[model samples]
Target: MAKVNGKYETIFIVNPNLGEEAIAAIVEKFKTLIEKNGTVESVDDWGKRRMAYEINDLREGYYTLIQFESAPTFPAELDRIYKITDGVMRSIIISRD
Candidate 1:
């Protein structure tokens, strides 16, 4: 089968209630997941930041940005993972290519 790899950027916010250790673990989990399914180019941890609006009655979150190259079909799986994770507050995946 042919690989249809494309560049993608994902920005996700995790609940601020989580401890630093837990937050780091979550970031690592996603990094590994992306690297395993694709190629991780960069990971930028923006740390905690104020949200523009409230979500789940929370006003702040830990932000992370990951740039990667992956097969076209892989994003849906990533999105699904993000949705099911307990601490994730919001996320977005966009094609950079």
Candidate 2:
């Protein structure tokens, strides 16, 4: 677990069409990236869900959360990848205490 000080909480939506293997691959990819010099405190599969809005015409998505300790710049890199990933419908990251 990360310390009681501030960290990051991120929720990235995966394309619902992606199966377990693909999803695992994607998760591993991000896990490696985010925790390169730090540690992942928690990960949660929020499961498949319906998006409140449309994204690439995808209405339903697989939601997951990753809490980690890292530099502030890390979230920017995460956002960049999320923007271009074909398997991600949407993503959001926030600071957590």
Model number with the top TM-score: 1
**Model 2 misplaced regions, further than 4 Å:** 1-6
Cα lDDT tens digits, model 2, 1-97, are 6444349988998887889889878877888888784679999988888989988888888889999987766778788988888797778989885
Q: Which digits, one per residue and each the tens of the lDDT, describe model 1 over residues 1-97? A: 7878999999999998999988999999999999999999999999999999999999899999999999999999999999999899999999999
Candidate achieving the largest lDDT: 1
Give the total clashing residue pairs for model 2.
0
Global lDDT for candidate 2? 0.83
TM-score of 2: 0.83
Model 2: which ten-residue window has the lowest total lDDT?
1-10
